[model samples]
Target: MGIRTLVAMLAVALVVIGALATQESYKVFMPGLLQGAVLTIEIAVLGSLLAIVMGVLAALARMYGPAPLRWLATVYVEIFRGTSALVQLFWLFFVLPQFGVMLDAFLVAVLALGLNVGAYGSEVVRGAIQSVARGQWEASTALNMSRPQMLRRIILPQAFVAMIPPWGNLFIELLKSTALVSLITLSDLAFKAQQMNQNTFKTIPIFTLVLLMYLAMSLVVTIGMRLLERRASLGLARGKAA
Candidate 1:
């Protein structure tokens, strides 16, 4: 079978093994882990949505906004991209409270990770938009289309296709970064694994399960992104033909 098929089968095998573990073991571990996994999924989904919004807004601001807006967007992009995500997390969770700007741990996790990933995503968007052929811009202008009209009708749809692959990579990176949220007391998958390991001392079994769980999640993301890319590509092709 193909490599993807093999990996998928292996993940399924591991999941089956987890399910078939002793009742005591299953009861001890599975509930907590599944709960954490749910929370992790929640965080990833919210963070990804925020990241997409921020990336697009920042990219548009930097490219087309007035001087003040461009400067602000530049500062945001450079600061977030230049710093460590961990540091950003710590600052949001630990340091912000010092200014009486207390925030919920979950909120901090989503904001920190979303903003960090978004900084990189902004660059991807900028590059993809730039990659669209200048001829398309000229043609749109010749049609007497306004800047926003041209961008909406011609430029963005094409750039969106080019943006998909890099956005996929950034999303995967964002998924991995969710582990850091555990440090701030959010019970994500990594936090659950550590808590289980400490309580039961089933180091190998617990960690191995955690590894498989993360792999399963990343695989799902990869598959979803690939499907999205394929669908976008087909749409782009059709658009070109028409």
Candidate 2:
């Protein structure tokens, strides 16, 4: 009856339409698409792990550590963020071979994805940490908590709540960006789709299939992150109650 209800119904109808369309598209590219989809997931998951680790470390160094540490973090973030991700992959995959620094294609893809996403992610981390209240820090200090203890016990848990939404967006972006790895012969979703188009000449349907596959993957990430956010929020609530 109301506008909110109407909007909800419209959204549901759109989802149903999309689902039906994807079903038709899936028949056009089935078994050939499976391996590429799997590899895409594998790359995205591992790359995201590396990205989170780097982002957190870089953020902490820039925020709380010594001047030299801050400078190093700054340089790392700036270099990766300033440069193109494709260029980073090219250097790692192509140029490095000349210097005998060759890496496996999968490894190169993973590292490039991680480092580039991590650079942008560092700012998210820094901002989340900064968002935690000053009073919380003072309270932890008043309790004679050590720096590490305060960070582990008080600061990080709260910062994590604020970090989830941005990190979710970054994760999905990283997943989509995995398509680039196909450029270097990684045989991911995009590459597989390219092959389908080359042989079948059904670019529209094949790419439509790829789009649905990516959308499915993104949905999974969104749902997982939502669960994580709920858990983090509950944990924060408990910590505050204590």
Candidate 3:
């Protein structure tokens, strides 16, 4: 057999061995896994929510604000997107305490994840909002619509449709990024896996479980995003037809 085939066979054998080893001790893994999953989900959900809100605000600032305001928004986006999330997480957890600001692990994770993702999400949101044609803006103005009214009635509705795909993409990234929170003793999936491996000396089995759990969560997010994308498109089609 080729090297690739040999490697695949060895990988399969390793998985089988790991599974067999962990099978008898399933009860010990279950509680930790459940708790870890909960923490993972909570971090992803809360972080994504904060990211969506801040991203929208940032996008709006960049797209419509005064020159200095836009510059500030641009700087914020660039700074966050430029830095390493792990570094940011560490700062939030460790350095912030030195400045007389104390945050719990969960909050620190949420803040770091949200801030990191928001920078990327802002660009997506800004592009989506801008994708509404220039003609549409002029038409709204010609119809004597105020700026707020134009955005509300003519621009935002369409922009939201465009934003769905990018938002979904950000969510997937956010979900995976939650693993980094384990470093801060958050008891997330990675943390649980580490704990199991340390206690049981079954690193391979523990990590195999972690891999599967991350894969399962990612798949769920992917399917949900696809559904949302379809719904957004369907709404747009129906509106156009009407």
Candidate 4:
């Protein structure tokens, strides 16, 4: 079986085991965790959108923009990708206010995770764009198409297919990283689990539930991305036929 299948099966099995192990405690914990999960999903959705935008912009700048823009994009990708994500979060949340830039906790969490993941995603974008055959570029040039026109009309639609799988991986990584928001005082799933554990000392059941909840969320993202990949592949095929 594929890794996704394995992960989903493992998560389901754990859920069953947890349910059998702690039937009563689940009733007490599920409500709070579900509430926190809503926030986690919200942050992840918004963060993924931002990451897509940043990744595309940075990749284009590095590949096609003027010298200054290329330099700036390179710097951004290097700094964000090279540094620790936890430190990045701390800088945004704890250090920024000292400079009179007070962002909301939710906003900071989104920014930190989005920008961090976007840095890696920029490389994915660049590689996908590069993976397009050289002959396609030559054909576009023969038609005297401008860079933007060629990219929008020919290259990107094709490159997008290559991008989807890697982007799916990045999205799941971003989802897992949402747990970091709890350290910034955002009441995400991990935070709720910790709060419940502290209050009742039910560490095993609470953390087990937390693991299953996260696995379920990641599986949902995996399924969504797979559907998207299939749709994009179909669209590309249709475009070629036309």
lDDT of model 1 at residue 221? 77
Comparison by lDDT, 3 against 4, better one: 4
How many angstroms is residue 176 displaced in model 3 relative to the true structure, after the best TM-score fit? 0.7
lDDT of 2 by residue, 1-242 (tens): 33355345545544753564568555657777878999999999999999999999999999888999999999999999999999998889999999988799999999999999999999999999898999999999999999999999999889988999899999999999999999999999999999888988888777866776787677767767766776778846533321
The candidate scoring highest on lDDT is 4
51-83: candidate 1 lDDT, tens digit per residue: 999999999999999999999999999999999
Query: 83-199 in candidate 3: lDDT tens per residue?
Result: 989999999999999999999999999999999999999999899888888999999999999998998899988888788868888998999999999999889988888888888
Q: What are the root-mean-square deviations of the candidates from the true structure over C-alphas?
A: 3.0, 4.4, 6.5, 3.4
Sorted by lDDT (best first), the order is 4, 1, 2, 3
TM-score versus the correct structure, for each prediction: 0.91, 0.87, 0.86, 0.91
Model 4 scores worst on lDDT over the 10 consecutive residues at 233-242
What TM-score, to 2 decimals, does candidate 4 have? 0.91
lDDT of 3: 0.83
CA lDDT of 114 in candidate 1?
98
lDDT computed for candidate 4: 0.89
Decide which is better by lDDT, 1 or 2.
1
Q: State the C-alpha lDDT per candidate.
A: 0.87, 0.86, 0.83, 0.89
Clash pairs of candidate 1?
none
Which rank order by TM-score, best down to worst?
A: 1, 4, 2, 3
Clashes of each: 0, 0, 0, 0
